[model samples]
Target: MRSPCCDNRGNNNKGAWSKEEDQKLIDYIRAHGRVCWRSLPKAAGLLRCGKSCRLRWINYLRPDVKRGRFEEDEEDLIIKLHALLGNRWSLIAGRLPGRTDNEVKNYWNSHLRKKLASMGIDPDNHRVIHNARLHRSHSSSNATRSSIDKSTNGLQNNSENGFRDDDDLNLDLTISLPSSQRTGSDHLQNTASRTLLLFP
Candidate 1:
């Protein structure tokens, strides 16, 4: 069986990575390129678990990984993308060039969640909390009013057939048959003259 990622019994290092460890990982990847995470840790001489090594390289050490603060435009894009895609961080990060899913997720949890809540928006559902409450209140009252209005106006507005008197109630619904049944033959056309059969 394939072993667990960070087997506690093993002497695998945990917590923060040092500069030397980082260099070793970078050097190994630069020379050989990423092969397999499970094998990479031992091959690269890293004491870290394969999962840790992979995360370090992808989220931090990769040359293409964008460092420093996220730009204003990037933040806006993140917010909009989050609204559309919900918690699918990897997909959201895909749009913002060089941003890793971990970085984007951390930024959202640390910064954006609070920022949105401050503006009265529920960070989870991305809805205006106040407006949502108001909407519920208004919806319930409107539903009640609508029910009362329908009951009061039913007799006056509708005839015995449960239809408005002045309304054009056409019971003439047409059904087009298959093309095989609608052939150009005169005898067939005569037999099925109208194509549509009406019922009273």
Candidate 2:
């Protein structure tokens, strides 16, 4: 298999691409078209690695790439898609023509995340912060209501059984029966015994 772009780290340039570099890359791609990323850098006379060339071309130098501020509708679509797709920026960018995945991600980090925060929505989960808190409190209230009902039931049971609040009942119960071995008369006797034990 062919080695990765990072394997040849010694000679490749590491910093920002100059206008000359960009022009060379653009011209090469325009003439030959985008092909094998691994071989494209050497063919284009760029000292940068294939991956860097690919990113520069795709993100910046592409003729079709959109520049300037995102439109209002585009912003709304990004919010909606981000809600549904989370951090899948490529998928979100796919829905917006001429937008790059890196652009969308950077926009989210720099702008949209803060925008959502200002609006009291969690950017990560796209939930209203107030609604999330309300849900938690609502759940806790439900639990509190159920506990109150249980305590009331317990008080009623205590009053009926003539027991104090501190008193405890033997609530442990067990049943053992061999249905195949039990005759009709044996079953009746067992039932009668169980009823007496429970009542007493």
Candidate 3:
């Protein structure tokens, strides 16, 4: 079918594509390769627009695109990569050849996220959901700390903060500060401020 994006440049179809349209796209791509999306539709005698053709090819018609349900290994790798990569689905998809970025993103939102939630892990942060409680703790503590600061004129809590509960949350973090930020009385004051995440 032609896509609305085509400006009906002569009854261009839109919405769901037909089997014939799919075949046309596949045959065209198979014959001439999938480059020059902006010119591909006309070259292939399709009413569809270039953008639609590109999406159809990348998400469905491509010879290497995987179909059916995601495998267990893919699910596991998705979780692990998600923990490290967050919403960079393109990067994640690159690791799994034959899997498209949209497919991974959809599977994550529709299925794997729920699976993680069922197991008490946050798919977003890839950490225990309860650790979100730390945010509340941090806020209240900051409030208290603020009040204490007003009263004591510079009092500090340098003992141990709950943010160090990485083992409980199943998170590992490293920190690096620019020399400009790290070299100050902060070193003498024994305060480490806001360099708690470093990933290479």
Worst 10 residues of 2 by lDDT: 191-200
Model 1 C-alpha lDDT per residue in residues 124-164, reported as the tens digit of each score? 65554665333223443344333323432332256664556
The TM-scores of all predictions, comma-separated, are: 0.63, 0.63, 0.61
lDDT of each: 0.65, 0.66, 0.63
Window of ten residues with lowest summed lDDT in model 3: 150-159
Give Cα distance to truth, residue 100, candidate 3, Å: 0.6
Look at candidate 1 and give me any clashing residue pairs: none
Q: Show where candidate 3 strays beyond 4 Å.
A: 1-10, 131-200
Residue 16 lDDT in model 1? 94
Which model is ahead, 1 or 3, in terms of TM-score?
1
